[model samples]
Target: MKWQNSLKDYQLYLKIERGLSKNSIDNYILDVKKLIDYLDANHINISPVSISSEIVQQFIYEVAKTVNSRSQSRIISGLRSFFNYLIFEDYRADNPLELIESPKIGRKLPDTLAEEEIDQIISAVDLSKPEGERNRAMLETLYGCGLRVSELINLKLSDLFFEEGFIKVTGKGDKQRFVPIVDATKNYINIYRYQIRIHTNIQSGHEDTLFLNRRGKQLTRAMVFTIIKQLVEKIGLKKKISPHTFRHSFATHLLQNNADLRSIQLMLGHESITTTEIYVHLDRQHLKGVVEKFHPRK
Candidate 1:
């Protein structure tokens, strides 16, 4: 099969069969394209169905000269997965990437904010400004829902089901799940909606959007990062913090409070429990407490 046709089909497979996010699918495609570009630059005519293990290894080695080990490992993994998919569909007789080895890299744990630190950051917002109410609700939603910044920004007014005690969240790959909302979070959101947002002349496309900028447009990812960064600076938090720290804290807190890993996985919108397991490291006390409370010898 032609390389272009194979790449397009593989992209569709990743989206439909694997349920990967659009961003993830694009990254995988880019990895494959990178390999193709390398081959073309070297004047090598290799088809996806006919490439040998040696050429694949050489391409990887050449890529290693340009990218970091972590990036290289990711490219290797993405390519391996693509090749495996091709083999599964019987498009190729043999997998050229079967002998490829991923780089040995340590697991990098996500940064989590402490409950008290989160409180401090939330408290640092000057509530006198018109945006303060929105900021408060935004932060509350981010931590409460365990939402990624992109999800938070794109959340809609129609997604609220307060009477049902749940909020519909559109997660990665456009997957939708309803998460329960507490009274405090709902109250903060309502206050922002009625008090600040109601008075503003919202832009046309952003009328249904929950969070808006000063100009009544939808909040961008960079704006969310800036808001969190400014709050961190105000509180003198030394730990490396970002919008994602709130999400990490949300999962960590729930896991510490005896919430099930499977439930947290669903809330965090992670396809694998392993992605949610990183939060397990955050609650050392929970582990010790579990051992102390359950182990007979303790």
Candidate 2:
């Protein structure tokens, strides 16, 4: 089959069967496209089902010169998944990348802000502007809920269950979970909603969206990143941070304060407890405290 035809089918499989998000599907498709591009550039004519491991290896060798190990590893994984899909569909007898191995890279720890640093960033918001309260509420919800940027952006008014003290978050793969909301976060959201949001001329189809831009439409992910970047600059803080930093800080702080991994896993909407265990590495003191408190030898 043609590369494009196989890619189209792979995209559908990723979306419908694997339930991957658009961003994920796009990345997977991009990996395959890169291989197709490489073949075209080298004057090699080969279809997806007919491409040999040597050609794929040559493409990877070229890729290594351009990208870092982590990114290269991701591309390798993406290509592997694509070929595996072909194998599953009976188009190929085996995955071409089955014998390939990803480069060994150390687990990169997430950057986390201290509690005081978090306070400083939040306080840097200029309350004089009409969007000030809204910004505060958005930041609060991001940190307080440990929400992914996508989840924060897609949050709806109907998701807020204030009386029940939990907000329903639709996470990766459209999986929904109820995250406990604190009084402080709830109050900030209320202030923004009742005072500021009510005055804005919300556009149709975005009426139920929890956060909106000045145009009365839903806020984009880039807008959220820009908001946090401006705040970081205003505070004169040197550490590079994004919306995800607040999430890392939330999970890190929780782990530091003796919170269990499983609970943090649930709160962070992690599909695996192993994902939450990274926070354990972030807080060595917490682990020390645990050992000292409960270890039989201690």
Candidate 3:
């Protein structure tokens, strides 16, 4: 079968059966496309079904030269998933990546801001401008609720449950979770929604969208990054940060203050407690304090 046909079928399965997002399906497709591009560039005429492990290995060898170990590992993993899909469909007998092993890479810890740093960044906003309140509210929600940038951008008006002190969040694979929202976060959001947002002429289909661009359309992920970038630069902060920094900070701060990992996991929408354990590692000093404060021996 043609490589294109195989890839098209795989994307459909990912979307329909696996329930992968468009971004995820696109990434998987890119992995296969890289192999196809390599074959075409080398003038090799073998079809996907007829391709050998050696050729795939050669492509990986070439990929290793240009990317870091982490990225190389991801590309290899993507290709492995594609081949596994082929095997599952009975189009191919085995995975080309069966014998291949990923390189040893450390789990890089996420960066976080302290309370003061977060405050300074928010304080740096020019409240004189019309967008300032929106910016402040967005940053507040980001740090307060520990939201992913995608989740923040996709937040809707109907999702707010102020009386219940919660807001609905749509996470990875479209899983919905109701995260607690404090009055402070709700007040900030209300300032934007009631004051600034009311004046703007929202675009069609974006009326429910919580955040908007100058055109009153839904905010993009890139726009969120850009907003954080400008804020970091304005505050002259040295640490590299993104919209996700607030999320990491939210988890880290909670852990340091003696909040349980399971509760933090629920707040962060992490499927596993292990994912939340990284914050525990970040606050060993706090753990030591806990032992010193409450232990009977002390």
Candidate 4:
């Protein structure tokens, strides 16, 4: 089949069957497109079913020259998934990249802010402007809920259930989870909703969306990144952080305070307990305390 035709089918499967978000599908397609582009640039004419592992390996070797190991590993994973889909669909008998191994990369721990630093970041919001309250509420909700940037942007007015102290979050693969919201977070959200959001002329499709830009449309992930970047610059903090940093901080602080891993897993909507265990970034003092308190020999 033509590369484009195969890609279209792959995207359809990702959306309809896999339930992956648009951004995720785009990245997978981009990985395949990179391979296609390489073949075209080299004057090689080959169909998806006919492409050999050697050609794929050549493309990967060239990609390694430009991207770091982590990114290279992701590209390899994306391509492997695509070929696995092809094999499942009977388009190919086997994956071309099956013999090729992804490059080994170390497990990179997430950077977390201290509680005081988190407060400083939130305090950097200038309350003089209308978006100030909205920004504070957004940041608070992000940290309080341990939300991914996508989850934060897609939050809806209907999702808030303050009376029950829980908010419904639609996470990756369109899976839904109920995460408890603290009264403080609820108050900030309520403040923004009643005071600020009500004033904006709501857009047609995004009326139920909790957070919006000045234009009333839902905020993009890039916009969220930009907001945090400006705040870090304003506060003169030296840590490289993103919207996810707040999430890391949330989980880190909770773990540091003795919250269980399983509960954090449920709150974060992680599919695996192992994924949640990455937040086990406990310091030496906490580790020592745990050993002293719970060790059998102690």
- In candidate 1, stretches whose alpha carbon ends up further than 4 angstroms from where it belongs are 16-19, 282-286
Q: Give the TM-score of candidate 1.
A: 0.91
Q: What is the lDDT of residue 237 in candidate 2?
A: 97
The ten-residue window of minimal lDDT in model 4 covers 276-285
Predicted structure with the largest TM-score when compared to the true one: 2
Q: What value does the lDDT take at residue 97 in candidate 4?
A: 94
lDDT of 3 by residue, 1-298 (tens): 9999999999999999998778888998998999999999999999888799899999999998998899889999999999888899998998889888888888888898989999999999899998899999999999999999999999999999999999999987787899999999999999999989999999999999999988999989998898889989998999999999999999999888878899999989988988888876655676688999989998
Task: Please provide, for model 2 over 1-298, each residue's C-alpha lDDT reduced to its tens digit, 9 standing for 90 to 100.
Answer: 9988998899999999999889889999999999999999999998999888888988899999999999999999999999989989999998888787888888889999999999999999988999999999999999999999999999999999999999999998788999999999999999999999999999999999999999999999999999999999998999989999999999999888778889999999999998888776654666787899989999
Per-candidate TM-scores read 0.91, 0.97, 0.96, 0.96
When sorted by TM-score, best at the front, the candidate numbers are: 2, 4, 3, 1
Write down the lDDT that model 3 would get: 0.91
Residue-level lDDT for 295 in candidate 3: 98
Best by lDDT: 4
The list of candidate 3 runs beyond 4 A from truth reads: 294-298
TM-score, cand. 4 vs. native: 0.96
List clashing residue pairs in candidate 1.
none
Against the reference, the lDDT scores of all candidates come to: 0.90, 0.93, 0.91, 0.94
Model 3: colliding residue pairs: none
Better of 2 and 4 by TM-score: 2
